[model samples]
Target: MSHLQAHAQSATKSAVRPEHGNDVSPHRFCVAPMLDWTDRHERYFLRLLSRHARLYTEMVTTGALLHGDVKRHLQFNAAEHPVALQLGGSEPDALAHCAELAEKWGYDEINLNVGCPSDRVQSGKFGACLMAEPELVADCVRAMRAATAVPVTVKSRIGIDDKDSDEFLQRFVAVVADAGCRTFIVHARIAVLQGLSPKQNRDIPPLNYPRVQRLKQRFPELQIIINGGINTLAQAQALTDGSDGIALDGVMMGREAYHNPYTLAHADQQLFAEDSAVPSRADVMAAYLPYVEAQLAQGTLLQHMTRHILGLYKGQNGGRLFRRHLSENAFRKNAGISVLKDACALADTHASLPPHEQPDDNLRNHA
Candidate 1:
């Protein structure tokens, strides 16, 4: 067996939580509010892997909630408890209205997106541009907090463009803090709004962990969660040394969970030690088969579900074979649980590969 596969196997076995234990407390180690990639199905899949980690929904625009089907957009599985709904808007009223709707939908928290640097988001006068207007963000937070009993939080970049400095961040946090927001999830980087794509915004900007740590130290009473470029369990653990929590998206949740699912399995053991019993890859796949079949019955494409599992066997002996089989067979005319079974067989076959061979990408792109 390869070292990667050996590590995966050991990690999986070590991460398993007992079936009867239901008292494990949920922690703040969370998945970021990813756009388009963290839908209900995806959140359900992630919940299956880590029961105690908080999950975040994709960012829902205020316009969507006020004009669109609020329940359809906000509804999620009961299994996905401790979930936070991320809202995008600059209008305090619209945001408050959306927060009420979110609370009714049973979300545990409401988060304002002030870090996304996408052009579309900019056109809407929201996202990272709000960093330049701290007062507006404060109002939005105040409105949302008053509208609901659940905690209203902010997810923001350290700075943007010419404003990339400690002073800018300090001022930004101070203003938001004045509005009664006790929790801040800071993506530890500056966002270049004028030229970079949202994807590049997440990568091109350098991660300033020290600045974030200082922010936490400065505001000792606030629950500060550090995000950006956190991929491995060790990296997440490292951040927790100084911060209240760690937020990971594409790196650890989407890509890593897909590619190296064992990493997630291990997270239960290493990170949330009280509730460490994670299901094996085969068990996870088996549990998900019914959901996949149900989605297929509703005419949902296989790729939609299979895409989330592409990295499940990464670093295992048959990792490539498993990926190839799922990639090839999942979209077949009558594909069903058998396709997943075949993929699982391949994963089991290659379970002995070395760790270095594992295709785990360290960069998490949430654009």
Candidate 2:
């Protein structure tokens, strides 16, 4: 059986039901909800790499749904199933309304964005700053749960700024969970909202996996999945299998997955145990080309889709040439499917050569 087919078959057998409902969570392996990175096209591309990794949409604020283009923000390919929509806002009523829209749009889960440290998110009274106001977050969760049958989840930091303590985190989780949130995707770093930039916040804060592990131990009933600094499959396996003592639920990978998406190629078999042949980089692009063509026919710019695949050949031979070909050509006025095909040809050509015969390019070392 193909890995994707096997995953479909074994999904029910591997599901872990929470105390509240029979809904099987796709939380075991998830890709973080990055602001501009996890869009519909990107999610569809990643889906071709791994069928079991739960995908999340980039955060859509209540204001966007309430006033802006709703179809643009909520519409997604049905193939991207087990997908979640990450909403950014603090108002309970607005959140509830958006939650209803999420259900109407057929999203599998509704995740509140409580972990973004951007200045924009703070000005709007949402994101990581909400960790300090647990009661308000609980109200948001309560209202959202009432609006839809889909799972209402939260993705928050360990703590925010000075409130960076175990007790503070415990209180935040306790309050939100009390309002019907069962799964928590915790970024192990506290958001330094005062002096750091959002990019700095993702890197500067030292990761505290043990703190998150303790969170699972403290609230044994909640499904606690740890995020932040998880870069490898070995690391992902260690956390989920609890090799270090307390096994939480799962691991959410961010930048690593984006820069080297092929890392997820073995996730279905290794992480979910749906054993089958892993798809090669060529196999992935071959499957994705048809989707690219369809999107292009629908007026989507080729650059928007091509940019996501630039990192698909990150470490392989001719990877630099592949990126260069796309980066230089895909932005042209009439760029089409042939641009992608040519880029793939560059990667495939150099990949078949001996190491010594390959072109002398070391830029990937710095990339």
Candidate 3:
């Protein structure tokens, strides 16, 4: 047996310890920490749509936090509470240090990334490849848990390459959970390391959700959150409401949430059972504008924020006009908040018109 396999067999399984004697924060509905997609602006926009769903920062590498400008990487708007910081690294000490930084920056949780299939992540000795070295992952989790009071969780794939078996995954979880990591977000698919691009890794491999269901059955005390191929609200609902009372604690949506962000409009009332009235899609954008103006005054490029919102009106009338207005004008020199207002005006006009009377948006079909 490999040393990690040897260690996994020897390590004793115990109940995971909570940081500060409290349970990990509820992550019943989460927006995945997509690389370029879930940056601070995108997270803030997502927050406007769902008050109760948890949000995550784009995965920050240990190198970025330890040697790069720390403030730029860690600063987030105060409105984005209940946000987790996802870190990508394999070194135990560096991860521990980064965990400390996350806690100091007021992140609610720290997540280690072991699911990313990119060659860049592989070059760093982390991501999906770490599944083969469960002992090292255990060490990193142990050090991180020791460094901060915030919950230290892990996001990992079911397997990597030819090691895609239930036994391999079970062993990995056994070792990490033994090291005090309680919450696990499993991307229910194999990460084919060699032949596919990162994009293909996300879609080409068939998702084996039943394996994740088996995981919850085996480790009932651990909070298991399932990811991969969950896009629509109905599918999220059916999966969370498993046969009988058996269910995973959460559902995390990635591309679905970004590509059709309006889908999250129903999350608060549905998944969180929140009593407050949900905001309409336009109202969500209206509320988002003040923040946009504030950011513009600070000299950040409008496209940095506007690029993420082009999909805000997906499936709505005049959605194309809204997107076209921003897409064409947002990056212009000194482009102010007027662009957003004018775009919304088009969308609102469509809302008021009768279906037959609404102008043909040829661009809408292409959009």
Best candidate, TM-score-wise?
2
The reply for model 3, stretches above 4 Å from the true place, is 1-25, 362-367
Between prediction 1 and prediction 3, the one with superior lDDT is 3
The TM-score measured for candidate 3 stands at 0.91
Best-to-worst order by TM-score is 2, 3, 1
Candidate 1: tens digits of C-alpha lDDT, residues 142-189: 999899998898989999999988889989999999999988888888
Q: What is each predicted model's overall lDDT from 0 to 1?
A: 0.75, 0.88, 0.84
Which portions of model 1 show Cα errors greater than 4 Å? 1-27, 243-259, 352-367
How does residue 227 of candidate 2 score in lDDT? 95
- Summed over model 3, clashes come to 0
Collision count for each candidate, in order = 19, 0, 0
lDDT per residue for candidate 2 within 52-135, as digits (tens), equals 788899999999999999999999877677789999999999999999999999888999999999999999999999999999
Each candidate's root-mean-square deviation in Å? 7.7, 4.4, 10.1
List the candidates ranked by lDDT, beginning with the highest. 2, 3, 1
Better of 2 and 3 by lDDT: 2
TM-score of each: 0.83, 0.92, 0.91
